[model samples]
Every structure is written in C-alpha cells, then in structure tokens.
Target: MNKNGNIGVTSENIFPIIKKFLYSDHEIFLRELVSNAVDATQKLKTLASVGEFKGDLGDLTVHVKFDENTITISDRGIGMTAEEIDKYINQIAFSGAEEFVEKYKNDAAAIIGHFGLGFYSSFMVSKKVEIVTKSYKDAPAVKWSCDGTPTYTLEETEKADRGTDIILYIDDENKDFLNQQKIQELLTKYCRFLPVPIAFGKKQEWKDGKYVDTDEDNIINDTTPAWVRKPSELKDEDYIKFYHELYPMADDPLFWIHLNVDYPFHLTGILYFPRIKSNIDLHRNKIQLYCNQVFVTDSVEGIVPEFLTLLHGVIDSPDIPLNV
Candidate 1:
C-alpha cells in the first residue's frame, strides 16, 4: 500500500521522463490544463440542471491571469473535497498519477488525464502550485498547496465563492506561461467553444492610437456551442456556419456527421469532412476534440477512428480521454 498524502511513488524520476519522452508538443500543456478546467465547469452546470446543487450559478468563467511570476487559472466549478483530493491526487500505482507522469513527462501533450493526472501537470511548468477551491456543498473552502517536491499542505481557507483557483508559480525554466500573448494563443486554440465562458483578459478596442480596455470581459469561449445542441434544431446552414467559425481560412467542408450518442457512453458533436488538398498530414490536426465543447486536443487520431481525423470542425465527446 502507498503512503497517504504522498505525491508519488516515483516522483523524483518522473520530471526527467516528462522532459525527455512523453509529449512531442510541449506547448500543448497549456491546452490540456485549461480544457480540464473547462470540463469541470461544464460538469457543474450539468449537475446543477439535475438539481444536485441549488446554489446560484455565477458567471461560469475560466479566467487565465498571468503576471511576471505566476500564471493563475481560476474557474467557477465543482471543486474537490479533501477526501476527493486524497483519492485523486495522493495515491499512485500502475495507473496512478506517479506512473502516468513518469511515462509521459517528456511528452507534454501526452500528460493529459488519461490516468487522471491532468491537475498534476501543473508541476511541469511551475516550481510551486496552489489550488484554492470550495466544493459545491456547504463545506468550507480549502487551499491545497504543493511545491515541485513530494510534500503538500492542504488547509482551510477563506474563499467566498464555490470554485477553484489554480495558481502556478512560474518556474525559472517554464516562464513562457507568464507571457500574455502566449497565454492568449493557448486559450484561443484550446478553449474557444467551452460550455462556460473563459476570459483571458479585458476586451480591448482600438482607441486613439492604441488598444484600450473596454468594460466587456474578453470572453474566450462560446458557452453554448452548436455541437451541444440537438441536430433536429439545427439546419445544414447552421452546420456550415459553425464550420467557418472553426476554420475561417479553409474551404467549406464536404459533409458532416452529427454524433449524439448517449447510451454506452456520452458523446456529441459535429465532425465535418473538409476538402483534403492532397497533403493529408497537413490537414491531420484540423479535427478538434472537445469534452462538452471545451477543446481538449486537435490531434484526435486515437480517439476517433484514424479516418475521422482527416475531417475538420469539432468533435465534442466527454467519453474521449482528455489526453487523447
């Protein structure tokens, strides 16, 4: 049996493994983490609809704020309690967080929550991480703070809201997360259609000679995306319109498949077959994967059949693993 409150069985060796072998695309770490936040927020909405919680649903937004020293991802969602954290964060075995990190530490894109290790990927970019969260239940808010080492401290905190605020103390090596442009790019790439609104910064308008902040929050996502809606309610033009929303520069898609299965597993979305222009590899990443409209990966080859990856537009399937 593993020790309680321990980070990982093979914690020390995992970072090196991630840096060397796991993800071919290191920049994708930002996408994965933000998507996970979006998924959590959407799940809360679903729960609320079923009368799980009667609390007021505030602005369901995922805010990405970055400064010189840290990058913070805050979300209004269903947060984990201490016991949930112990089950999800502390234990490590074959399919545990430690083993997953060691196996995919190098591949940043590979460090998704396939083995339920999505939250821990924060360690890859930060020297220290703090999770300030309050569960939807009437429990007191808690702050779970951890450094890169195996030790962590979870204590009660004063959070007025019911959500999570993940603060990543940007490490000396991974300071790129602190860059405003870089963070914005990741948000646009990974979180354009999340069920809840995601805000990266203030809405800017060209004023006088420079960009000036507007009263509007710069929302980065479409809370109610087309994929989440019933196909009967949508027309061919609606699907075409959404396709252009995804690929502005590209030509119209050939045909589309509206996937809305909820029996064996929950899945929904519109997969459009774009016009392939000879170079299949160039168009390989055009198909975007979303868990409840929160973008998870553009590389959807593994989750969808290999043939489906050639298509463009969105595939919003909660059944698919975040890592895939």
Candidate 2:
C-alpha cells in the first residue's frame, strides 16, 4: 500500500463548512459562547493576580439575556479593542485563546477554548452578530458587526463597561432560541458546573397571587462541584447530596469513588454506583464528561470501560482530546 503524506482541503469558505459540518447540533452555539466568556473572565483574573491589571475585579458573572428577537451574552472579562477584533475576529481561525494560553501556561489554571472557530458558530442560529468590547487597558470601545456573509464592519462605539457583549439577532429559522425557558434549559445542560457564575434571567417567587421575578439573579452554575473539590474535605453526606443534585429523584447510591489523578494527564471526578435496574441502556448516558468544568458530553464510551459508563456521576479533564 502506497501511504500518502496527507490529504488536502480545497474549500476556502470556512463558514459554510462550520455551518454544515463542524458541529452537528445547532444548540452548541450556547456552549461555545459561554465557554469563551468564561475564558475571557479567567484571563482577566490571571492578569489581576500577576499585578498586570490593578483595577478591582468586579462581578465576573457571565450574563445571558434575551429579548424577543435577540440574545446578548455579557462578560466582565478582558475585553478587546478594534485592533484585537481585526486580529481575532476578522482573520478567521487566528486563535486568540491559543496565544493567551501559551503566554500564561504556568499562571493560568484552566482555559476552555482551543479553536478560534467558536465565534462564528453564532451564525448558525443568528442572522446577524455584533461584538461590543472595550479592552481593560485604557482604550476606546468598538463594535464589530457582521451578517451571514464574509463581509463585516468595525467602528468606534460607546460602551461604559470594560468587557465584552456578544449580541445575536435570531434568524427566522432558529427563532426558538429567543424563548427564555429554552435558553435556561440549554444553560443548565451545558454550564451547570462552570467555574464562573452565569446569570440567565431571575429567580421567581410566589407573590400575592401568581409568581413574580425576585431581586435575585438566576445563577445557573455551581462554581465548585464536589468533583473539583478534595475528597478529604468531603463527608459521606456530601457525596450523596451531589449525587442527588445530579439525579434529583434517584435514591442514594450504593457506593461512590472520588477520583483525583495527575500522572499521565490531570483528571478529577466522582463516580457513583447507582441502583442498577434491568434496563441497562437507560444508565449508559448517566455519566457526564467535562473539560475544565465546561460540560462536554454525557457520552463517555471511549474514555472508560463499557461497563463502567453505566455508573452515574461526572468526569472532567482538560487534556481529553474531543473531536468536537
């Protein structure tokens, strides 16, 4: 057999390829945007820790807000200037995340982005997208707007904050994302255990007659899941509690194992032996997989033994090379 050196790509348009192939699920746009926001927030924290930025780190929550026709993801992270937008956004696939990670490899703990292609995933569900951002350094804020095409516009804009806001105008085909309940559901599924607190809408309370929005923000994640914590610091009850948090109606697990490994590759997680029923297939997808607390998938067929995958719990490792 004559082995070839490598295959070559012919298509120059990356957006269409991302639209038709990169990710199968259109809902993945939410995970990608939120992960980027977390990365930005994390990068700022790193800068502040190293005395690069002396400003007070305000509330770093990534907020997801939507009106009838648009959804805006706001983060109080290291924002970008016009020049950065030109480098990161306009010059598609030039990864800012990769560069940041390399520079701060020792200082940074966990960063969730690898491919710069994440931003364009917005176009899968959006007719138009806008990025309003201001760098943490003394600089003017700018707005970058683009439709579904390759062309874009970047101009000086007024923004009081020193972070970024990604606004997406919902397309007619993907109008279901504009719904509040739908967004909350997706956030819960993808960002339930992220490192940063994410606010979606507001907590509801039973008022005089019906339910009303409370002053509290509906924070969607637990920054410190039990898996990420030291097992020595936890009790038997803590494991049970976390298991129920993952499976609300299920009974107490028969046994549980707390995993904390850092040899070949860093890994941390907890596995619970749930009360197995005759229908084994039902339990196959119970084990959730993550990369640096960002939910990757519930399917872990390749990562673990076929039988062990039936156990319920979580496994997170930044080193896991996922195809997605």
Candidate 2 Cα deviation (angstroms), residue 93: 4.0
**Per-residue lDDT for 116-221 in model 2, tens only?**
4577789888888989999998988988887766667777889998999999999898899999889989999889899999999899999899999998999999
- By TM-score, the best candidate is 2
lDDT of each: 0.73, 0.80
Taking all chains together, each candidate's TM-score versus the true structure is 0.81, 0.87
Q: Which ten residues in a row have the lowest lDDT in candidate 2?
A: 1-10
Error of 1 at 132 (Å): 1.5
Which parts of model 1 are misplaced by more than 4 Å? 1-5, 8-12, 15-24, 94-111, 262-267, 273-285, 299-311
Q: Give the local distance difference test score of model 2.
A: 0.80
